[model samples]
Target: MKETELRYVLALLRVQGIGDIFAKKLIQHCGGAEAVFTADAAILHRIDGIGEIAIQRLKAPAVLEKADAELEYIRKHNIKVLYYQDDDYPERLKHCIDGPVLLFTAGKISFPEQKIISIVGTRQVTPYGTEFCKKLIADLAPLNPVIVSGFAYGVDIVAHQAAMEHQLQTIGVLAHGLNQTYPPAHRKYCPKMEENGGFVTEFWSSSNPDKENFVKRNRIVAGMSEATIVIESAGKGGSLITAGMANDYNRDVFAVPGRVTDKYSQGCNNLIKTQKANVLTDAADLVYMLNWDLAAEKCKPVQKQLFVALEEEEEKVYQYLNSKGKEVIDRIALECNLPIYKVASLLLKMELKGVIRPLPGKLFEAV
Candidate 1:
């Protein structure tokens, strides 16, 4: 967070072809950013990826001014800047090939070093996609993993909103700068995120939300998490891109399979078929794949019996109802693959047990 180090990091980013990898090397060679600024061209040229043109640009007055301006902008906005060497830098992302030399963060929430999962999918989500995300998030909530995702609509929005509702710390990697929020309609939810979670981006304050930035943003999402989950997507979308990057980074990639005929499910199904991602049918599938042990040693004796009493079918119905938000008896019967009379009787019993409540029009939801 030193001013001199911040300025040099910004300057390094401006140099052509000198990205996070080379920047770290330069920092190591020169001892620090302050020293990097003072080092001669001959010294800079010896480092890999540093060409004559870039070294000259680094020494130029105009380039220095631009770096200074970036610092001034950060100062004016009260933004938090994280350098690669800083302890606060996300450890999962620090080793990424294209990780940013500096990150501009706009909120107070600290990134957790524990299990982190990125949920991504098509911007145009279907009803099934929505329910899948809500259910997955609800089940994962108890594990306390930090949820990461883009702030785009569809799966990203649902993931973030559900995480917030569950009181889980979530991080949104933005396609643009923190100066503005893309899809301005999301402005309302952002403050809630800043209040409860955080927002992050590698772009400078004035950087526009260009088409290409989204591709760049995907790397941050994939690299910063222990795993990536594709809720729904077509063959092409940012979610797929993130999944590919996650694989490249040797991180676990899980995809939710939908009906084979559904366009949104095709991408996920294909990923699983090709062995590019693990098939995720529910939260337990993800938990098992990630090898997450949900067991706690301090639990009350009665709590274990309470959980054991519920049959698998009851748990499925409970989770489905919680995820669906609301559904008619007929719809639940269809979705759960249960007979109408059987579903109706179970619904009444569950209601009496305070597991769910019924509303008008035969709608029911978990209490």
Candidate 2:
């Protein structure tokens, strides 16, 4: 965004009684952020939600002064600002009405046709949860999905570490400003994270990690991903809140089921019992549900492996594709007399074996 426009956006957010939704409404109704300030009072009053108080707040000179100071802080720190209307913003997050109007980022973070998933859980992570998180990320590494978390204790750090271990990009969504790290101990991980995936926040330099800020931050964790996975949680925790937010956003939510006797398993069990989340046994469940396996094939070169072994069902699909060439998955399933779910699993296996390749519009061919 241009410096002038950014200043207006910052000022717009600083105005009392205005938030992301209203700021966006104002920006759109008046053409742009600058226009919102310049719009005539008569025209502003004509808009639905614009009341007298809000219009009066828009005229505050201190708002622009604060914006200028914040803009300076942004520039001095080399922060990257992602405007909601810009293409560079997270596409999934763009759909969220309450998503930040301005997202401040650090490090080299890019969202290029990538599969992004957020993994969140309790701060008191059990050994079982840690192992599950590690194994999940390791298994899903081949598909190369971006791992997102709140950058808190336990499950959050574990997920971020696992992603880094697999050489996958991991993002840390913070409740506080970019100027400082919460929990302070996790400060060591910042440099490494920024090198690859980095940190993102809607908070300003003055903002602190207050209690309510985390609840607000949870929405971003849930909003930016294709799905949100809960490794473990107590009866009522932030991870459950994130799951709730994900459900509200109509995004897939998965919970790793544990023994009912376990203290941390209560939340996951409740979510499953209420049908708010799908039971996640392993990485395959997520891969299958999100159709990520089919999408993963596109990331690789279509080179046929010599003398590759295939399962009985896999051979059927392979034979059909070999003869028919590129075909939709549904057609391949019909021709091979295999179920669609089975076909999807086989296709992913075959792709891993370098026997078949995916095409645009969900078509596939024998490599």
Candidate 3:
């Protein structure tokens, strides 16, 4: 977009009560950002959402001055500004109703037709979560999926680091502006991350990483990707919110299962129990659900290679689930001639082993 046009767009964004959806509506009715400023009063009144107050806001000189200052900062920093209608903007994101009208990016970024998945979890990541996050990326290394995350602590940073370890491109979606990095410890990773995959945000130079921004940030993480995977979370956390957004976007959502006793696992477990998310044991589960197998099936069609050995009893449960598609726990014990307690124990072990997964209402199915 031309600098003149960008100036108008920025000013429009600064208008109070005019959010992304409304901004897009205004632009559509007014022809373009620049035209919005010059449109006749009669024309402006005809637009559905544009009224006296909005027109008054548009006429404010202060808005243009602020936009000019922000434009200068962006130019100085060499940030790539993506207008919502630009050809280079993320195509998947454009389809989202609440996607930003402008996105500022810094880094060497590319969103090819290859897989792009967001991996999110608790900021206080557990050792188990770390291992699983690392292993999942490692298993997916061959495909070189573009890893996306919040760029915060815990699973977000771990996912980025794992992707870096495998030389895969990784993008960090920040709640703050590109002018600074939050959690200064993460500053060290910013340079290397930008070299491969950089930071992207809708926030401008003046915005700080406040509490509310993180929740708003979750929508971008969820909207841009075809799917989202929750590595671990508490019963209520931002990660679950991101998963919910992904589901609302009609994107695939996956949650790693953890023991019911673990606090962080409760969120993920509840997601599965409620059927809000699919059971994501390993990369293969994601691969199968997303039909990523089409890419690897050419070289290797060993989806079952992801499975591990089950004990004689666990095997009985696994085979039963595999054959039946999904079975309730009591029925599995009755069919396998095992006690309900023993079946429950075997199911937990099997779930941990990634052979079978638990569904809502006590259903179990083979992975």
Q: Which candidate wins on lDDT?
A: 2
Per-residue lDDT of 282 in model 2: 73
How do the residues 319-366 of candidate 3 rate in per-residue lDDT, one tens digit apiece?
778888988867998999998656755765555455666566657788
How many clashes does the backbone of model 1 have?
Answer: 0
**Stretches of model 2 off by over 4 angstroms after superposition:** 294-367
Superposed Cα deviation of residue 27, candidate 1 (Å): 1.6
Q: Candidates ranked by TM-score, best first? A: 2, 1, 3
lDDT of 1 by residue, 1-367 (tens): 7897788788877776677787788888999877887998888878877788777877777767788898899989989988877898899888887788888987766865577899999999999999989988876676677889999988999999999998888999999988898889899998889876789999987699999999999999999899999999998888999999999999999999989899999899989999999988777567546655443232111122233345666777888999988898778888899876567546644543457765655567777
After superposing candidate 3, which stretches have Cα over 4 Å from the reference? Answer: 294-367
Tell me each candidate's TM-score: 0.82, 0.86, 0.81
Superposition TM-score, candidate 1 onto the true structure: 0.82
Best by TM-score: 2
lDDT per residue (tens digit) for residues 14-47 in model 2 = 9988999999998999999999999999999998
Q: What's the lDDT for all of these models? A: 0.82, 0.91, 0.87
Report the number of clashing residue pairs per model: 0, 0, 0
